[model samples]
Target: MTRWTQAAVLARMRQEIEASAPDPGDRLPTERALAAAIGCSRQTLRAALARLEAEGEIWRRHGQGTFRGRAPLGHPVRETVRLQAATPEQLMQARLLIEPAIAAEAARRASRSDAQYLLRLVEDGRVATSRGGAEEADARFHRGVAEVAANPILIGLLDHLADARRRAAWQREWDRTYRRIGVGEFVGLHSDQHQSVVTGIAEGNADVAEQAMRAHLLTIATAMRRGSDPADPGL
Candidate 1:
């Protein structure tokens, strides 16, 4: 019997692709068909496909078959269903990995207009008339920072994160955490962190901007993750 492992399947799959001369954005065969052609089980073929997707040799749409190359123009860049179900901790980890770098980039690219916009956003978030208003302003502030970075890829990532926040599960956890924190704590803690981040951006200080953004995200993660897992250490 042949040991048709994931790596072996991946090799066969690549040979097929090379033979076919797959064009960018061309649709690949379905997993079952591909597996049959490659003489492998569906599970092994799936593992190989995941590697290809991560390497940008292919991309997947939720309901569509995998396609060659990066995501097509105007199509969803990521599988939105995953983000739609991500827990607060998962989102926090993603934000920690992504947003701090964008904050630093925004600092490096800061213009007079960018500084003014960030400052205005900070003030709006600070003085929001109600809890809902404050949350909206906070969302805008983060989105504005990604915009100031001036990178379409970074902006797209933040846009996906925003969509995640609108999902029912994410929103429920967010609302619970916000209620626990209360408006006074938001004004005292989170608002101050926002001011610090914008100040770093306005000053074009990349180090300060990154640090402030990381700290801000940490504070939020701590609040949302609290009691969800008693052993999580709330980091």
Candidate 2:
């Protein structure tokens, strides 16, 4: 098999092992069995198994055979149940509290690649918004901010918040109502705020980045509370 094929086979094996967790120190299917199952040579299967063992997703015992290992633990939940089920207002409040600190950290710690990634996300958001694809752009923009923050703990917390935001049925209804009302100016304002935050980060101005992020989130909250269509200029 080609090197690429070997890599693909290895990934498949890892996926299978992950899917069937808690193997409880039992020996995995024999190398010959895995080779037959995956249509690869025994040598290829062994290489893949070796990689998995090195990665600690699987382990081998002396003469016992390979077994699935434990997965890494994830961070503990940060927000309360009430916060997790936040309304638009509550989401905005949480955003205001969380994102400013995130921006400040980004200013302090962002590497060149991180800033470039964020810029790319902003550019993509601009394109998506122009094409009337606001949701995708909005998600990308928020995720980009989390990336720039460069803290796994913060990223996990933000991810949970984003997940909650996506699951809110009322948010969709509000977007529909605002769009029906013909509000387009808010998008421009939001885009500007995004640019401001980016500029602050690029300049290494922690205070400015923090304040800009806070203001941007607060503007969103105000717009949502007023039932303003983010896309409507007249609003």
Q: Per-residue alpha-carbon lDDT of model 1 for 1-235, expressed as tens digits? A: 3568667778898877665425554556788778778887787788898998898887777665666666644324555535533566788899999999999999999998999998898888778777888888888989999999999999999988877676555666777776676776665677899889988999999999999999999989888877355565533
Candidate 1 pairs with clashing backbones:
none
Lowest lDDT block of 10, candidate 2:
71-80
Model 1 global lDDT (CA atoms, 0 to 1): 0.79
**Predicted structure with the largest lDDT when compared to the true one:** 1
Query: What shift in Å separates residue 155 of candidate 2 from its native position after superposition?
Result: 0.6
Error of 1 at 122 (Å): 0.4
Task: Write down the worst ten-residue block by lDDT for model 1.
Answer: 72-81
Residue 197 C-alpha lDDT in model 2: 88
Question: Which regions in candidate 2 have their CA more than 4 angstroms from the true location?
Answer: 1-84, 129-132, 180-187, 228-234
The count of backbone overlaps in candidate 1 is 0
